[model samples]
Target: NRLLLDLETDLFATCCYVDVDMEEGSAWYVRAGHLPPVLRHPDGRTEVPESEPGPPLGVIRQTDFPMSPLRLQPGTILALTTDGLVESVEVDIEDGLNRLAAGLAGSDPSHLGLVADELLTEANRSDDVALLLMRFDGMDVLPSRESWTVWRVPEAVRHARRYTRRALRSWGVADHTDAALLIVSELVTNALVHTDGQVRLDLTLIHRRLRIAVADNSPRTPIKPTNIGWEATGGRGILLVEAMSDTWGTVPVSGGKQVWSELSLD
Candidate 1:
């Protein structure tokens, strides 16, 4: 678990990437309101593990963190991030996540270290950022333990729309397709021009809920665009997601951070 000075929200970001191996076939890990990790499989599937995150560190005496047993197999890559990586001045946090995922997909296993390092670069921000990439070898013969893919990139709305749709479909999520697509488009546009590729994206559906996460390498979280002239074209994405989702928030990763949102199924 990691701690962040929530009061000094403007000064710093905490981020981390860790991998611990257990002797058993199944292993359990705990989260205290930390940025949940994205699970990737060799099969090109992606997901955010379902577990109870107690609360961000230092806020309370002790958080009752939930433990989740991960089914480890060969070629499993789990990417975890911090808040400095996603929430930003330009892109909506969610869209930043989409771009991160796109970049992860093209990353090679041999370059796992580079992938984590480049993840921060892709965001193009100065905020403290940390990412952990975990790979489990020999998954094909393992039961229950699967594999997934991750991708990241910097481009315009058009490019985001193309990939978000493909990614959701690839994971067999078709119900709220249009809404997800729109969210991705909005986030991407904000990232390319405003922040330093300072965006991260993750797509996953677990227990019937669709999870979309975007982490920027930036510590600057989104604020309602308040300028009068900004009303029509600005801050609409935040409003759109706030109106369309169940819940959302931000978390400190290692060096910088992350913002996440979720939509419940009909």
Candidate 2:
């Protein structure tokens, strides 16, 4: 939102942003004076969801782009496109959207590339057209996931470690138990000490990899310390996480940020 506000005086653009969580079988999107996404279900039913959009980018300052959520069942196909593909001088936007949805309802989702090409066969040639299509199949073998909310108490770190250890043991990854526990302790402790609002610890085990995630209501990402002397007592949590996990990163969620680290059990 701040980025769009900064551009309010210089540029005019519309955007539709969508984020999909396959594991959760859900999607969240926000439209900024853009077209609503078209969804085709597994049963061949299609509809343009009723989406409330904010003003076009660079048109308003301090605007709140309210997000709309959608549940994506298995074999659901989602389509997002620009006006060139759906609207023309001869056709109204509403009719164009209906036509697009109808076209999507008849296409085969297995051939997404071909489906995209077919959708563009009737696009307005005078303008640039863009289309993005996604088919959510959901996970065939869902990973084992457990989440625990951390209370604002002194024993939070210990409790986090205990949870991590138990989860790792149950998943048959006891070999990496110590390392996972340490990583969880550091991440949860950092979230408790540095941020406010609710804190949560999540563990996901899929195959031979284990993922540890700590979510907090703050959007500020953890910063890594460049240099630490012998006397330094803090600013090493992120560093420890990096050193212990095969991969680690942070992502923005609905109202907060999630710091996640992945470990390979092999």
Candidate 3:
């Protein structure tokens, strides 16, 4: 939305955004004046999801894009496309959409590339045509996650450390408990001191890697201090988190951002 406003032009665009969570076997999607996505179930069934959509981009300021959630089973295929493939002067869009769904139901999902080619062969190309298809096979080994809401009290940092220690021990990764606790403390303290709204600490164990994530209702990314004097007592939380973990990064989420650190148990 902010991106469209920055353009400052009369031209607007439609969009369909999707976010998939493999661990949870679910996805969230929002359509901005775009066609509903088509889904093919594992049993060779097809249907278009019915979800409300927001206005086209650059047409509304501060518009709320409502998201719809879809639970994905193994072997489910999701298809997104532009209206050019389903709308033409001679054909109604509803009929065209039904034809597209029927085509998907008959195609083989094992060969996605071939399926895409076959679908495009029948498209009405008077305008631009685009297609995106994804098969959700799901994760073979799901990660174990534990989350704790950090209160805005003085004992928040200590409580976060204790939670991390317990989770690490339960996951049989207690050997790295000290480092994990330090990372959690630094991250939780940073979020509590610097950000606003509810703060959460999440510990995830997948295979032999452990991921420590701190999420808060703020979009600001953590800044790494370039220099630190010997007498400096603060602004070292990010540095400590970086040094303690193999990799650390931040990603934007629905309402805010999540800062995460990953350590390899190997």
The candidate, 1 or 3, that scores higher on lDDT is: 3
In the range 95-138, model 1's lDDT, one tens digit per residue, is 66666676677677666888787777866466766666777674
Where's the lowest-lDDT run of ten residues in candidate 3?
1-10
Better of 1 and 2 by lDDT: 2
Writing each residue's lDDT as its tens digit, candidate 3 over 103-193 gives 9999999999999999999888778999999999988898988999999998989988888888888888899988898899899988998
Q: Sort all candidates by lDDT, best to worst.
A: 3, 2, 1
**Top-TM-score candidate index:** 3
Give TM-scores for every candidate, taking all chains together and pairing residue i with residue i.
0.42, 0.82, 0.83
lDDT of 3 at 159: 84
* Residue 51 Cα positional deviation in candidate 3, in Å, after optimal superposition: 3.2
Number of clashes recorded per candidate: 50, 1, 0
Who is ahead in TM-score, 2 or 3?
3
After superposition on all CA atoms, what RMSD does each candidate show versus the true structure? Answer: 19.5, 3.0, 3.0
Candidate 2 pairs with clashing backbones: 8-58
